[model samples]
Target chain A: MMNVWTLFIPELYCLLMAVVFFGLAMSARPNPRRDYFAALFMAGVGVVVALACVRLEGTLFFEAYRVDLFSQVFKVMLAMGFFLVVCLCTELNGIEERHHPEFYLFLTTCTLAMMMLVSSVELLTIYVALELSSYSLYILVPLRRGHGVDVEAGIKYLMVGACASAVMLFGLSYVFGVTHTTYLVEIIHVLPGVIGTPAAIVGLLLVLCGFFFKLAVFPFHFWAPDVYQGAANQVTAYIATASKVAAVAIIMRVVALSGGSSKYLVDMLVTLSIASMTLGNLVAIVQKDMKRLLAYSSISHAGYVLIGILSMSATGYASAIFYALAYLVMNLCCFLVVVKVSHDGSDLKIAQLAGLHRRAPLLAMALMLAVFGLAGIPPTIGFTGKFLVFAAAMEKGYVALVIIAMINATISLYYYILVVKAAYLMEPDEELPRLPVSIPTKVLTVALVTAMVVFGVAPSYLLEVARAAARMLM
Target chain B: MIVPYSHILMFAGILFAMGIFCAVARRNLIMMLIGVEIMLNAAGLAFVAAALRWQQLEGQVFVLFIFAIAAAEVSVGLALIVYAYRRTGSLDPETYNILRW
Candidate 1:
């Protein structure tokens, strides 16, 4: 009983934090001030506290929610990401001052929902958790001040998200009708027997559609670029990193339903992977806006991650996990620079990065490392992640897929280097003064850059953990 | 004995398809929300019918949760509509493209 309670500590803490933040926001009188720093402090503490629970394992609520090695590992990654993002959000200039605490409230709620999402082993719980997170994000987008684009992105995100979830629910109904059970463990036991049937295949794919939307895979990825560009830089960072981490975890969970040898699922995954990589990389080449460029780049990376997932093996799952963590760090490093550079809280263009090295040397160096890592250049974690994922695909005899992935990588390198060149070689205007950087941001930049290279060169510890976590799903 | 399970499923499927069509075809934001509501209700109807056929309480329970979720989604959905309307002065999605590449 105590252990069960312990397993729930992180979620309870998050809920408490959200409620407390809301209360603080509501009760403030003449000052009308919300403690943004406190919000960041709580998020940082919450993640650190969550990290301590990595070893505890239990199931509660009639085994509907699982607190296993796999879930805990993902939870730690998510919490850490939440912490870093809150830190990065220290100055959310785009948001109105009074709404500061409310913003943190939504952020915590979304994070809490994601925490629940990974732990849920029941279908109904999964849907509810997904909605909770989705709704929170829907509200967060439009919170940006008086911008038609933000509202537009909010509406598009809401409508598309609602449609996708409805489609997913329609599929879930079929899954329930076919399997007659909503618990994942039971479904896993029964699915292999029925999965070869048309109903099972369709139902499973439909269920996957919800997660695919979150992951921004091909057909479901349309909202990502627009929303990324429309939302605040901090919100975009949260969406790109932490939300993506949750999507990867859930995708692994759902795909595990097939029980090892579903060729049809493999075919579907292959098609999505190839299309996402090709389309994402191709569109990214012409993107002028920094956020939109990163959005397409993220979509392409989603494709690379799929190569591991579709392999349907432990090595594949582990590689995907490694890649997700690496992607999170590299992407956040880039966003940190964007957040700092866009001092007025407006969208940034690619050309705006000209002479970043001269404006701020540390930032320029950090951005270089991130772009190099994203482009999958060697001695960075991105290369290691891609190599492992591609190797996993080859192990599964996906020769054609591997070749296409390589081509996408080459195409992606072009745009990534273009940004680097603008940052390093081109010169800024004479009048604009040097960009100011506080001590903490400088420290974070150093840490993020160092981690990218260190983890790339010596990935044994992370690889072993990832392999262990992947084995749990098997 | 009164109604076959296939008929219930067929009815639900048609309802769902209609809901999807309204959602995709309609230009008005409110109409799209209505379509989503219809789709969700169709899903609930299917779950209830399946529950009756299977004689399991879980399906009925799931429908109840769906209703709760659909309600929450609608409230949020409407609030967003109002928010967007206030900002853009129109409900048409065509006019709201600022971040296009």
Candidate 2:
């Protein structure tokens, strides 16, 4: 019994943190500093808790939830993401001070739900956990203060999300009908043999639509740009980083069910991958809002991650996992600059970053490294990640797919360089005062830059761990 | 079993189609929410039929989850709709277009 409790430590700790924030929210006085400090402390402790349980392995809840390296690694990532997003909440001006505790509460719950999501091995459990996280975000999107567009973004997110889940549920019913079992382990044994049938392939593809919505893949990507632009900067950071990591984990799990036997599924994934990469890169070029540009770039990155997942090999899965970690760090680095530069919590236009080098040299340098990393330039973690993913695909005899992805990478570089130029070269029309750099934020920027380069140069250790985690899926 | 699993699936599929049509074709936010609810129920109906066809209790249990989640979705969806309605005084999704690409 004690060991069982240990298996649930990370999730239980997150729940406790949520309860604490709930109590804070119910208090009469609105204390932003107290709320911020409480959140920061709890989230930091949450990361430690997740890391502490990384080596423990057990099944809980009658085998519905599995605890293993894959889930634990993602839990650590989620906790780290929560902690970093809280660190950016120093101003919290995008939201009303009175709503600060509630914001933290929803974020904690979302993180908790994702923790559960990563551990769930049963279909019903997966559905419930996914819904729990999505609902929290639905409420969070509209919580931005004084933005009419936030509510609109919220409605669009809710509608598209509902439709996608509904489609996923219909597909789940079919999967249940065909396999006669709701356990993924059993389905993995049963699915590939029948994957050639129209019902099985259709059911599996429809099921993927739900996670595709979360990851902002092509057809389901309509909400990302609008929501990212409309929501508070911190909220966008959470959505862009942590939620995406969870989505990638689940997608890898679901795609693995096919067991690499079906040509139809591979063909379908290839088409979606190409479409997402091309469309995301092409549309991102014209975006003026920095967040929207990141949103489009995220859509394209989802395509790249899909390339790793669709390969259905252990190396492929490992590379995708590495890519997710790299994305979380680099994207957070970019958002850190955005949050610091837009200290007043308004939407940041690309042009607004002019003279950023003069205003805050550290932030500008961080931004440049992050953008280069996103563009997959050499000597950054993002480059190493993309290389691993493409190499995995190449080993699987997908020469054409890898070539197209390379073209997409080059196209993506154009916009990323455009962002770099705006930050370093362009002069502001009016001279602005040098932006104040808080000590903690400066420390964070330096740490992120170091991690990007260090991980890029020496990926063998992280790659080994990712390979171990991917082994669990097989 | 008596009705045949294929027929049940076909019926559920039609219901699901209607739900999708209502969700996409309707202009009012409330109608769109209702459409999603209908889609959930259709899936639930299919799950029940699947339970009988497979002679397993898992699919039946899954329908219960679907019902509960559908309720949760409706509550959240309605709350968001109500908030948006108050802010803009319009139920038309087109009116709330401040966030365009």
Candidate 3:
């Protein structure tokens, strides 16, 4: 019982911090450094709380919230991810300050929401948690002033997000109507018996609609390209990485809880996975904006993660988590370079990176590594993640699915190399400004870039953690 | 109290679908934002209907959270709408295409 109470401390602390940040932002003289310090403190406390939860795993809050190895691992990763985003955000001095600290306040609230989401053992709980994370993003997206693109992006995200969520809730109601319970464990208890029923199928699809939207899979991914292009660079980085990881964790939980897969469910998911991969990668090749190119690239990567779910095996789940972690590093490295390039208040463009190598060799090299990793080139974590996810699919005899994913993976390299060539081989548009980055950001980028490279070379530790998480889910 | 939840759900669903159509089909930004809010509220209505039908606590619990999210969404969505309107002085997305970059 004592452990059960301690399980909620991270969430409670963040919630309290959110209110405090909000009040401080409204009442006091503006100090960006203090605000960032406060954010780091909140993130550090969150990390500690997540560690404590992992150390004290037990059913808590009437079993509606889980505090098992799975939730704990996800919480730690999410906390660290938020901490990095805060580090990147603290340096955004160009963003005009009209209620500035609200940024950190909302970020804390969003992190609390994501932590709740991973621990959720009920459909309704997940729904609320998903909304909590999204609402924060809705405000955060339009934070870029003098750029109507940011506003456009926010509107697109909201419109799509709201629609997908409604569809999800309607589906949940149907599931509740059929199962006569909202508890996920109970839902699992009853799923095998009603695997082919219309209500179950509709309910599950509806639930998936919300997540697919969040993950930006095909058909539901229309808003992503626009949003990525329109949002501030750092905000785009956070949205592209952390937002989707939380969604993937929930998707993994749902599939694992549903007793692997039925013919109908697996069949539907395979189609979605294949379509998302093909469409996202193919569309990404034509993109001119640096952000849009990466956005579509992310969608393609999302499809690969979905394929991981389609395997419905421990290896599959673990690989998906591993891949998500890889995607985080690769996407952030790319965004860090984007932030660095635009550090002097210049436009963020693919062509603008013509002579980055001449101006900043290290930045150019890091960006190339990120893109190559994204393309799944050799000796990069992207390759390792892709190999594991596809290998898991093959193990489960998803031959057609695996083959389609392989084809998509090979096709993705062209576009990724296109970006790399532009950075390295393209001629200069003048001497590129020497981006003056804070030491913290430089250290953070190096760390993220190192994680990507090292994981590709030696993935045993994260693989073990992913396996532990998958076992807990099972 | 068989308020005919399927019928209520269907009604909300149709309204929600219409809202989506409005969002996708219309070019005006504010209209699209209104459409989004409507869709969210429709889901909220479905949640309440299910809660009442089942006499369960979860649906109501979820609805309250949805309301909270909807409130947050509205504040920022409108702010963006106003910003777009100010820059272009027209809510037309075509005019706002300065960001195709």
Candidate 4:
């Protein structure tokens, strides 16, 4: 029991925080302002607990959960992302009238579940944790009141999520049908003898489909833009940033577990990567809503990360992890601006960004930094991530794929720059809201933007850290 | 005589196809919920079939887990459906064009 205790301290903190915050919520008559602090405090405790786990590394609780540098780094990153999300969400004066308390509870619970997901080494553990994360989002989406888009978004997300989970379960059954083992290490040992079978490949592809849906890659990406545009802006940020990070982590873990590449899987992945990047960028060109644009951008980014995963080597996995970290910061920064500038909670349209420089100079500047970083421009972490991934692909002699990604990266720049131009170059039509945001949001935004630039310039530090973390996945 | 994996997969295939059709074709919100439930059961069937075929613990264990998650999903799905019906007065998704294509 002590082993389980140490393994799940962060989850315990989150569970306790939810109970306490519920008590606070029930007694305090829905103090939106106070509850925000409750979220921050819980997230802070979570991060500390996650860090403490870093020092104690071992397989615990019958090897269902593994605590190591790999899990530790991701858990801490997730906790911090949750903390920032909580801080950023505090100012959502808009959601106060709705079921806001329930919203915060599920948000915290979902983050806890995703943290568990990265640590789960057993197939059963991973399945349940994935569902835990999904259910929370199903509730959070419709909790947004006064908008039909919110309800619609919630339903769409649920339907697609359920289907994906089903596909994954079906695939899991196939794997079990063949291997008789769900322990990843054991499964890997057995796979070389059996994975060449057609049923095994079909199972693999089905499971990959489930993951691709979460990552929002091509053929499974139809739900992304609608869900992004229909949901509240902050909710969209959670889906695009934190959700993608978790999905990418799982992809890398599963890929590593394969030991080496299967020709079938590699060929399939390369084709998917090419399609995802091309379609994601080409469609993003016409998006009017900022959230929709970011949705497609994230899909393309997933494609780039997939290129690294396809490399099926240590450097490939490390670069993918590094790119995910870089994405978590740069993409969150982009959405932070969207949340900050659209204070009244109106979905930001490309046209509305006109004259942002005049309305809020500092925010516009932050937006520029984030967008440029996303476009993979130098002096931003996005460039560093893209460089490492492309180099890894080249190492694998995927020359055509690398060239395609470069062209797509260049194409992505145009749309991202369009947003910046709208912010700085266009003129406003009316007197904009001169909003004074709280300090927590300001701090969160600045932290992400700074991380983006610093990581871009001197990437070796984070790069080496990612490299070490990737080595542990096997 | 135990059920074969092929029979189970056939049933699952039929159920899955039916669920997709109902989810896509039905205008009633409750029908869509039923479709999702059917689809979920189909997935669970796959696990059960695989467990019997392989004589392994993992597949049946997966089925048990899916049942647990499916229960949770149904509750939430029903709640959202209720909310949507109360607001829209009908489950016809064609009317909810408030979302962009």
RMSD of each: 1.4, 0.7, 2.6, 2.0
State the fnat of model 3.
Answer: 0.45
Error in Å for residue A367 of model 3? 1.3
Interface RMSD of 2: 0.7
CAPRI-style quality class for the chain A–B interface of candidate 1: medium
DockQ list for all candidates: 0.72, 0.89, 0.45, 0.61
List the candidate numbers ranked by TM-score, top first: 2, 1, 4, 3
Screening candidate 4 with a backbone cut-off below 3 angstroms (N, C-alpha, C), the clashing residue pairs are none
Q: What ranges in model 4 sit over 4 Å off?
A: A1-4, A431-439, B1-7
Misplaced by over 4 Å in model 2 are none
Clashing pairs in 1: none
Q: What is the lDDT of residue B13 in candidate 4?
A: 73
What are the models' TM-scores? 0.98, 0.99, 0.92, 0.95
Most accurate candidate by TM-score: 2
Residue A127 displacement in candidate 4 (angstroms): 1.2
Model 3 spans > 4 angstroms off? A345-347, B1-15, B22-57, B60-76, B91-101
Task: Give the lowest summed-lDDT range of ten residues in model 4 chain A.
Answer: A90-99
Q: Report how far off residue B48 is in candidate 3 (Å).
A: 5.2
Candidate 3 residues B1-101, lDDT tens each? Answer: 65687788788778788878887788887787777777777777777777788788777787787778677777776876787677668878667555442
How close to the true structure is residue A133 of candidate 3, measured as C-alpha lDDT? 90
